[model samples]
Structure formats: structure tokens, C-alpha cells
Target: MSDVLRQWQALTASLPVKALGLAAWLLAMALVFGLLERRFPIRPQRFLRQRLAQDVGYYFLGGLVPPFLTVAATAALVWFASGLVPASFYAWVASLPFAVRVGAMVLLGDVAFYWAHRWSHENEWLWRMHAVHHSPTELDWLVNTRAHPLDLVFARAVSAVPIVVLGIRQGNDGLDAAVAVYLALTTLWAFFVHTNVRWHLGWLEQVVVTPAFHHWHHANLPGTLSRNYASLFPWIDRVFGTYHLPARQFPTTYGADRELPQTLGAQLASPFRKPPS
Candidate 1:
């Protein structure tokens, strides 16, 4: 039994082993949330078979997204900063305790994503890319995965580049583990936030992003088109002045006000085409 335990500990340190563990956790979240949505849909939503196929494709594809753009950006950053960054800084970060590294990842990741999410709304080219996400007429529990690959790539690049660079600037012993844990939290919470669950977790709204807050962000209503930009923490929006949470009422409608192609391929291709006048 002791020898078996030692072998398990050794396997845990392997990156692929850690990845498989993350996958199992995500699958468990999906199963739990899938049941909850059926029992407590906050609002009625449409879920056609075609949409199911599209989203299922996205759900799997999302797992493959981060590494592409994030890795590229990390490589570019390293090439550019090699001369300026101190080698010892990364060594120091590697030496820190695990909990501290994870805390920094959450704090820094939220800040990075908040700005990226907000910019996707204001920037024309990016909005064109991001508009595919808002194209969903209603929020499915899996709506988190319905994002365009480019949009996912870009949002990911924005979130990762800074954190990894900071690690490189300082050190990165625990950075990989921290990022993995943060991404897992971010992905799982996304399902809950987009679910049809009737949860209005009252005061909890002040602590973190909730379906109420995110629902409003996607709301097509007059006061809601461009508000509530923070992805993880509500306080960040509160500080930056984009916060727009209403305690009791939820948005009655959702989706982008613009025209979007109905088919997945067209929607994917739409970003490259000229916008409708």
C-alpha cells in the first residue's frame, strides 16, 4: 500500500496526469449542472437539436483552445523580453508556496479578463469577432462553449499573455498549476452562470459574478446592451464603472441586437466578412 501511494504521488506531478484530473473535474461539473438546469431553469430557453450539435462541438473544442494562442503569445513575449527579464525572478516565483501562486493567478487572471471582455464590446474589429457569441438568442447551459474559435483564442491570449509574462518577469515555479486551477474554475463557473437555473443567490451577487449579472450583460434590453463587463469579480466592474447588477429582477430578453448568420460555418466565417450596413 505504501509503494502504491508513492507511485500515485509520482504520477500526480506529471503534467498530463494533472490535465486528465482537470478533465475529470470538468466532466463532473457538467453532470451536476446538467441535472440542476432541468430542475430549476431561471427562465425558459429554447434548445433545438441543431444548436445542441453546435454547442457540443464547441464544448469539446474549448478544451483545445487555450494552448494555441496562449502558447504563441508566451513564446513571443519570451523572445522579446529575454534580455530585459532577470532569470532569478522566475526562480524566486518557483520557490514560493503553492497557495500564494494560486492566489496571484486568480487575482491577476480576473483583472486581465475584465479588460479583455470590455474591449471586445468597444472595439469594432473585435466586436465583429465577438458578435458570434452574442448571436445565441438564449443562454443554454453550454452557451459558454458557443464562442467563435477566434474569439476564444483572442480572449484567451488576452487573459494569459500578461499572467505568464508576469511569471517570467518574476518566476514561474507554481504558475502552471495556478493557471490550470484558475482556468478550471473559470470554465466550470461559466456553465453555472449561463444555465437556466432559477438561482438568484441574493447577497452572493456582491462576492462574485452570478447568472443575474452575466444574464444582464447578455441582455438585449435598452439599459443592458453594454453594461456589466467583469468576467470573474463584480467588484472590478464596480471600480471601473461598468457594473450594472439589479438585485431582484432578471433580464427578460437576451442576444445581440445585430444580424448574425444562423449556420455555424457562416457564423465562423462572418467575422472575416464585411459587416451588414
Candidate 2:
């Protein structure tokens, strides 16, 4: 209990630094993707499009809040998981080279994220939470931050928990570094894929996710909702039979057909609220 409280205190103390780091990332992404969208837009629009303020609200709320919740959620999961896995496995994992561990984490985390994202679409209750992310009619880098805290926590935990569970339980800095690398890769890629920039990197698209690939996932058209579920790697979707990309084409429309609450507070409360009778 003392350890948990100490950790919580440390985490709270670090919020300012974390929030500033996220702000830097958000600003850099906005500048880079903002310029790309302006130069070669899939759908030409202003920097401050409709609902920009709401998405910005989600940026801080979704970005700042989830780490706190995910730590608790993943800590519980890691406790149970560590007990199930043998000590030898973690020792072996800890023994591996730093680059190897990072590569392994990236592959493992991406696969977990693929299924978690797909489940969010297939499951009704999860969709209610995830719908907040898809509520935007416009697609841009800022929109990537527009996710419900529950949605953010769920997706993050599914990927992060397993990695932590399989990681060096004795607090090896290598495992810690590897997990950081995996997160950096996924976080930057998520924003890139959500950007409004019209990019289709020929053969390279097969290796990594691109805006065109993920834009189809956000497509409002029927039958396309279930496609492009992978975040970092397209091969996961290919293996799972969810990959869908067409040459010289992008989603004509964005966002879900179903109505979601428009405001941040309402959207946060929406998942728990019953629908109109």
C-alpha cells in the first residue's frame, strides 16, 4: 500500500512534465501534418475546422487522464499475469539484447492493438465508447487525440499490459526502454495515419500503415467500417483478413453514421447514459 501510494504521488508530481511533453508532441504533429494537409489534402479544409475546439479538449483529457487509469489497470493485470508466467520466461526476456527486445515489443504490441481496435468495432458496448473517436466528420492529426478516456485506456491497456506482463518483472531498464520504443512508434504512427494528408507510399504501404490505409477505416460507407484495423503494421490486417485499400482512392466521407454526443463532457458521459426510449 505504501508503494502504491508513493508511486501515485510520483505520478501526480510528474503530470506537469508529461502534459508538457504531450503538448510539444501535439504541437509538432500539428505543424508537420497541418502543413502536409494544406499542401496535399485528401479533403481540403482549414487548420481550425469545425469541432476543432472539442477535439483539442479531448487531446488534453484523453491524453492526460488515460496514463493514470492505465497504470492502475495494467498494474492489476500484471500482478495476476506475473503469477501465471514462470520466472524463467521473464529472466530469458530480460537477457535479450535491447534492440531485439524493442523489435519483439513492437511486433507484440501491434498485434494486440490490431485485435483490440477490431473488437472496438465489432462489439456494441465497446463501440459506444469508441464512437467518440469516430465522431469527427473531418480527419486530421488533431482528431487522433479525440478519443474517450475509456476508449483510450482500453486500447492502451490491451497492448501495454501484455508487454509488461511478458517483460522483465524485476524492473530491468532494457524492458522499460523497449516498451518506451514501442509506445513512441505506435503513438507517432497513430497520429500520422489519422492525418488528412493524401499519401499512398506504393510498395511501402504493405510494410507500414499510411493515411490512405487508415482513412478507409474511418470511411462512413457501409462494409468499409470493418476494414483496416491495424495501427502500425498492415500485415496484421492482411493476416486477419481485415485489410482494405484501393488504388487512387480515399474515403469520400469521414465519421460514423450513428449520432454521438457533440460536447466533450457529454461524450465522456455518453457511454454510461441509456439511449432515448
Candidate 3:
């Protein structure tokens, strides 16, 4: 146990060391999920020609960089836009109890995300950016992070960042705690929904977004395209008339109808390329 303690001590000694620890944790989680997929894969061919490198690149970029940039850019924008929103408006939010404030923050974030996600589908130019996420042919936990930078930024701005920035501006003491809890909750949920676990939560599917539910959103097959946009709550999709969770069914196909570029660089640039006639 002395060696283990020494390794732990070394890992915590510096910021880079801590990051290496995180990278190790991430790899372990990937291995765990990969094992789970092998045992309980939703599709039989889930492992066939695994796009390991392409997805790992996106997993890091989308999971780490985009979210950090979202918070940073939001903080900057809120600083500039603070003059527009009266201090009294957010002063009230700052005064709420911890539980209530986090609850409100989550709702505000989810609502913003819901609308922005819908807009990504409805707007063509936005779809170009959003398509990178839907280009996956296989469904698994790692696919959750395969989003475009624009897609991640836009969604965060619409949902979580606004509430967070407001909390920061309003002098909320628990903003850090709230943001951490919220990100934790969201990251867990995102991975859960993208999982290869063959689950169908009989009644709860009506309330929450499940892997089966989101698989439909990624489904490019007949009667399964461009629907189920809610990130956490399925009821929001019901309200918006985009919800379509067929009983005891998963999408047969997983990808956009058209082919997206295979390389990470090319996929990033594909959004900017003009659609071929």
C-alpha cells in the first residue's frame, strides 16, 4: 500500500499531475464502458470496425475544451451585458436557498438547452454545425461527446451558462457548488443516454431522457428523424411536439442520412463546406 500512497501523493503534487490522474480516470471509465458494451450491447455489431481514435479525439475536445470555453465566453459576455440586466433582477436569485437556487439553475439551463437544441434542427445553417454529433453510425457512451464546438457553445449559452453567469453577477456564494453539481449531473446523464446498455425504462421514459429515447434522436431511419431533442426531460419534447418514444423499440439506424467525413479535421471542416448539389 506504500507504493499506492506514493503514487497518489505524486499525482496530487501538481496541476499537470492532477490532470494525468483525470486522464487515467477517463481511460478507466472508457475501458469499463467498453467492457459493458461487450457484455450488453444494444446492437450485435457495435464493435465492428470501432472508430476508436476519431471518437477519442472528439471525446476530449467536446468533453473538455468546448465546455470550458462555454463558461469562459459566457462569463465575458455577461460582464459586458450586465449593464442590460438590472442588479435587482439577479439579486433576488442570489438570495434563494441553496437547494432552490440549484433547482432553478437546472431548470433555466434545461429550458435554454431545449430551445437551442430544437433550433439546431429547425435551422439549416445550425444543422451543419450540429450534424457532427449525429454522424455516428454506432451508439455508445463515448458518442455523447462527439459534438461540434459551435453545437456545444450554443447549447451551453442557451442553457447552463446563462443561469451560471447570472449567479456570478448576482454575488451568489454557492455558484461554484451549483455549477459543479449541475455539470456532474449533466455529464452523468449525457453518458447514460449514449450508453450501449439495452434498457427501456417502462414508465420513467415519459419523464426523463433515456438511451432508447435519445437513440431515436440519432436515428436517421423512417419515422425516427429530427425528433426527441430534450437533454434531461422528455416532457419538454412533449410540450414542443417533438417527442416520439415508440413502445419497446430502439432505432434501427444510427447516423445522418448522408455520410459525414471520417477524419476529425475533415468533420470539423465539413460543417463549413457548401452542400453539394
Candidate 4:
């Protein structure tokens, strides 16, 4: 227990600056989104009103919990694994060429996340855990954290498997660097993609994931609700043939057709129970 605490403190100490920077950036983006929503309000074609305070509160609490849990769980796992496995394994894996490790981490991580995300949609049991995310009637930057704890935990656990396996099999610093960079970028991109800003990068949506493209995923429109599951790159969607970019403007509606819980307890307990019928 003491060793675990020490390791946790060390990890947090090493990462504090980066975490603080990310928090600052997210706060700034939230402010910008709030300002934009006020300036160029999009009339809701749906019933829900913007609950800015609730949304901000949800983001603050939800965002902090998952990352802390993820990091702690990951650190514990890695620490234990290091004890069981030969140090040479991690060393060798980390020694692999930088480009190869980076490529492997990005591709493997995204593919893992992609399948996990798609399965959440396909499986009724898993969908319960994921439904809290879709319950939000509003689409804004903070709304991205509106996920059940189980859903977040499962996703992170699954995603880390590939990284862990790679580290043990080939142990390389490049892979570590790649994973770090990917997490940082993806975290920022998630906030940006969920923002209410209307900036579109023209043809770039064809390649990279953008706020406009992601907002469409949250759209309550029947067509878009079933499309755009890719987290970072659109190539996975295109390859799987699930990509659907409507020629029409963004959907005004958000959230599922069914009603969802508004209370914190209900949202936390949602994954275990069936969604409202």
C-alpha cells in the first residue's frame, strides 16, 4: 500500500504540469463555446433547453473522475506487470524504431477503441452503459464527459491492452511517447469536437475528425444516430462503410428518441438498468 501510494504520487507529480495545461485549455474552450452559444444560438428543433450550469458541473466532476481512475488503474497494472515480467521485455519493446512503435500504437489503439465503441452500439447490455452519453439533449464541449463510469473504465481498460502487450513484447520508449501524444491529442480533440462552434475546415472533414463531423454523430436525426462512430480518424468509418455525411445542414435535434435520467444517481446507475421504454 505504501509502495502503491508512493508510485501514485510520483506519477502524479511527473504529470501535473501536463494535466494542469489540459485543464486550462478545456476551461478556455468551454468559455468560448458558452460565448458562441449565446451569440449565435441555434434554435432547438427539440424539447431540451441548455442547462449550462448542470452541463459544466457534469463535465467538471465526470472529467476529473475518469482520468484519475484510468491513470491510477493503469499505473497499478503496469507496476504489477513490471514485477511479474522480465524488465528486458519492456526494454526491448521500447527500443523498437520510433516510427514503427508510434504507428503501431496509433493504429492498434484506434482500432481497439473503434471496435469497443461499435460494440457498445450493437450490444444491448453494453448500450445501457453508453446510453448516458447519448442522453444529453444538448451538444456542447462539456457534454462529451457525460458518460457512465463503467463505460469509461471499460473503454480505457480495453484500449490499454494493446499498449501493454506492445510494451511487454517489444518494450520501447517510442511506443510510450506515441501513447502519450495520442492520449493528449485525443483528449483535446474530444473537447474541440464536442464544442458548439460552427467552424468547418472545408474538405478536411474528409480526412480528420472535426467538431462539425462529431456533432452530427450526436444528432438526434435517425440517419446520423446510426453513423460516425470513429473517434479520431474517419478512415475506419469509410472502410467499414458506416460513414454517412449528410449534404444537408447539421441536425437541430440531439439525444435519443427515448427520455433519459437527469439526476446524478440515475445517470450513475443507468448502466445497470434498462433505459426508459
Candidate 5:
């Protein structure tokens, strides 16, 4: 039994370290924010109850579903692709001086992710799938995982394809490492930006995406819907002329004006349901 346990540990050790690090970061943030909400206490008690309920639901769904599905799907796809691709391809990329591969993955990954994100918004059918994420009535840490499985799979597959294609072209472990680190950091940032904590880094929002910056994206107000699309960097939105900065106050409401179905099964099926006319 001890030997079997040791073998299992060795097999699991190959899992990305970033995923573990991100889990730790999210737990710490949740604790800090939970305490802050208790201390500061946002007004309108009814609103607080609603937001809290939604957050609880968010975490429940996150814990029960999406994470496991995503990990399993990604692991399987990578394993399958590994078998078909030449070992020499990965080896060649790995042999390149580290800086070149790192730079390539970062730029290419962001570009791929940018298009995938934009498409999720622009296509109504895809938006239906994406809307599960936007359906949260309150913006908070847990809202990050409310995405539909199809949207999640599509976005991840698109984001990864560029790196995989790069690996095929140049053959490198550095690309894999860079992608793993980026995925971990981006996942943590998604949670951080969704968090209710009031921490702000001021003008740093222009460079690194922050919680306050993304909270506005969840704003259901008329004009706010079209703004703040960039996932990691604000410059992409700015460069493309889609950026919109909210006034000093956060928006008072969230979710579409039309009532979305409340049940989890209903939400999963929502993408196929007719959109509000």
C-alpha cells in the first residue's frame, strides 16, 4: 500500500504547480474578503442577502462541476496530442534560448485569447453560452466559474491551439511552461477581479487588470456592457477603442433586465433557449 501510494504521488507530481498555487491564493482571498464584508457591511440589507445567496450558489457550482471537467478535458487533450506529435518537436522548442520561446507564447496566447473572448461576446448563440457567467446578480469572487462548460472548453481550446501550433513549429518545453504559468496566473486573476474586495492599485489598472476594473464589466447598466473586454491587459480594449471607465461609484445593479432562469439545470440549458425579444 505504501509503495502504491508513492507511485500515485509520483504520477500526480507532473501536474502543473500553478494550479495548486492558484488554489491557495483564492482561498486566502476568500478569507480576507469574507472578513471585510463582515466588517464594512454594504448597505441595503436586502441587496446584501441577494448577493450573498448568489455567491454561495456560485461557489457551490464551481466546487461541484466546472473545475473538474476543465482539468480532465485539458489533461486528456494534451495527453492525446502528445502521442501524435513528434517528441522532437517539443525537444526542438525546448532547445531554443528560453527568452524567445517565452516571448512568443505570451504574445501569441494573448492574441488568441483576445479573439476567442471577442467572439464569445459578438455571437449571440455563443453569448447565450457565455451568459451563464454574466447572469450573476452580484459581482464577486465566485462568479468567475459560472461560465458554461461549452464556452469554457471553446475558450481554452482556442487559447491553447496557438501554443500547440507553436510547439509543433518550434518544438519547446519552454512554451509549455510559459503557457502553464500564464494559465495559473490568469485563473487567479479572474478570481481576484471577480472578488468584492475594495483593494485598488490606482492607475495600475491601465497595465494589469484589477478587481475594480473587471467589476465594471459585470455591470448591467446600459452603457457599461460594451466596455472592458480585455482579460489580462487593458491596453487591448484601449487600442481597439472598446474601453469605458465608470465614474467614481460602482454600478448599483447586475444581470440582464430580462429574468434568466434560476435553476442550475435551466442555466445549463439556457444557451439553447430563445433570447429575449
Candidate 6:
């Protein structure tokens, strides 16, 4: 108990540093993406549009997202996959060169994330939680932060748990560093793909996911929902038969069909409540 208390205190001690770092990163993202959107927006929108404040709230909330996701994913992994795989396998994977492990993790994580993301759309209960993210009528880089923490945990755990289970183990700084790189890559890419910029990458869209590909995933229009679930790679969606990108086109509308709570507190609590009749 004393050990646990020490760890908790240590974590709390680090919050200010983490929060400062996050604030700096957020400021940079706003400058870069904000300029891009203002110059080449897919859809015209104000710099300070409606719900901007709420999304800014989400920005800070998003900083806490990864740790919770990691904890939930690790706990789930130990609960489910414990004793299923040999210890030697994890050690062998961890023994690989740092670059190799990071490369493998990016591929493995995206594949896992693709299926998990698709399942969130297919599963009714998951959709209720995910709907909070989809409730935004406007899309931008900030929109990436607007997610239900529970939904974020569940969908990400499917990908994250496997990475934790199959590769990264505790106490190995090298493996831990690799996972951190993977997380940074995926998280930055998410912000890019959700940005409102109109600059399409042409053939690169086929290679990696672009705003065009992911915006379609967020499209609330008829026949556009549930396509393009892969977060990093576009091929995963193609392999899974969920890819749906059109040439020189973009989604006309964005958001979920159902009405969702607009405020942060209400959005967080929404998943546990029944939908209005």
C-alpha cells in the first residue's frame, strides 16, 4: 500500500510538467493547423466557431486520455491473455532491435485499431459512447480531442492491449520507448487526419490515411457512415472492405444523427444514460 501511494504521489507530482508540455504542444498545433485551415479549408468555418470552447476543454481532457487508456488496456490484457502466451515470446519480441520493434508495433497497432474502430461502429452500445465524438457538426484539428473517454478507452484498448500483450512489457525502458514512439506517431496522425484542410495528398492517400479518407469516416451523410476505419494505414480498410474514398470529393455533412449533449460534463455522463424516447 505504501508503494502504491508513493507511485500515485509521483504521478500527481508529474501532472504540472505534463500539463505544461501539453499546453505547448496544443499551442503549436493550433498555429500550424489553424493557418492551414484558414488558407485552404475544405469547408468554410470561423476560426472561433461554435463549440470551440468545448473542444478546448476536450483538449486538456485528451491529455489524460492516454494514461487511462494504457491502464485499462493493460488490465484487460492481463485479465484476458495471462497464461495464454509464453513468457519467452514476449521476451523475444522485446529483444528485437528498437527500430524493428517500433515498426512492428505501428503495423500491429493499426491493424488492431482498424478492427476495433469498425467494431465500435457495428456494436450498438459502443456507438452510444462514440457518438459523443461524432456529435461535432464542424471538423477541425481540435475535433480530434472531442471524444468520450470511455469510448476512447474501449476502442483503443483493442489495439493497445495487444501491443502491450504481444510486445511491450514493464521495466524495459527500450520497449517502453518504442511504444511511446508508436503512440506519438498515431496521435499526431490523428490530428492531421481530422484537420479541416483541403490539401489532398493525391496518391499518398492510397498509401497513408489522409484527411479525405478519415473525414469520410466521420461523414454522417447517408451511405457514407462506417467507411475508412483505419487510423494510420489506408490499406487496412481496403483489406477489410471498408475503404470508401472518392476522387476529388469530400463529405458534405459531418456529425451523428442523434442529438447529443453539448456540454462536456453531459457528454461524459451520456453513455450511462438511456436515450430519450
- Cα lDDT, all candidates: 0.74, 0.83, 0.76, 0.71, 0.68, 0.81
Please list the Cα RMSD from the true structure of every candidate, rounded to 1 decimal place. 6.8, 1.8, 6.8, 4.3, 6.0, 2.3
Backbone atom clashes (below 3 Å) for every candidate: 5, 0, 0, 9, 5, 0
lDDT of 1 by residue, 1-277 (tens): 3544554455445547556765686578667877787677776554453477777666655565445555555566656555666767767776777777677767777888888888898888888888877877777677877887778777777776556666632554555665667666787788778877778887889999998889888888886757887778899988888889876777778888688887877887887888868
Instruction: Write one digit per residue (lDDT tens) for candidate 6, span 1-277.
Output: 3544565566668888989998999999999999999999998899889998888888887675556445645665775665787878877876777767667778888899888788878888788888888888788999999887777777777877666777555346576776677678778989999999887798899899999998998998876678898888899988978889989788889998789986789988987888987
Tens-digit lDDT track of model 5 for 1-277: 3544554465456345635554675578668755655554332233354545555555544544454445555555566668877887778776878777777776676667777877887888888888788877766666786777778777877766767654733543455676668777877778767766666577887787777677777789886766787788878878877777664456677775456787777887888989778
Off by over 4 Å in 2: 168-173
Worst 10 residues of 5 by lDDT: 40-49
Candidate that beats the other on lDDT, 1 or 3, i.e. the better one: 3
TM-score of each: 0.82, 0.93, 0.85, 0.78, 0.72, 0.91
Q: With candidate 5 superimposed using the best TM-score fit, by how many Å does residue 228's alpha carbon deviate from the native?
A: 1.1
Candidate 3 lDDT over residue span 60-95, tens digit each: 566545645565556666666576778786787677
* Candidate 1, position 46, lDDT: 46
Better-scoring candidate (lDDT), 1 or 6 = 6
The lDDT leader among the candidates is 2
- Give the runs in model 4 whose Cα sits over 4 Å from its true position: 1-26, 35-49, 71-92, 168-178
Question: 2 or 4, which is superior by TM-score?
Answer: 2
Model 2 TM-score on a 0 to 1 scale: 0.93
**Relative to the unseen true structure, what is the Cα RMSD of model 4?**
4.3
Model 2: colliding residue pairs: none
Over the stretch 1-277, how does candidate 4's per-residue lDDT look in tens digits? 5665776576567575755765786678757766766555444222134655665556655555566567667776677676776877777766777787777777777778777888877788787878778887777667887777778877887777777755733543455566667787897788778876666677888888877778888888877766788888888888887787765356688886556677877767766776556
Error of 3 at 276 (Å): 0.4
lDDT of 1: 0.74
Query: Model 2: how far is 20 from its true place, Å?
Result: 2.9
Among all windows of 10 consecutive residues in model 6, the one with the lowest summed lDDT is 64-73
Better of 4 and 5 by TM-score: 4
When 1 and 4 are scored with lDDT, the better candidate is: 1
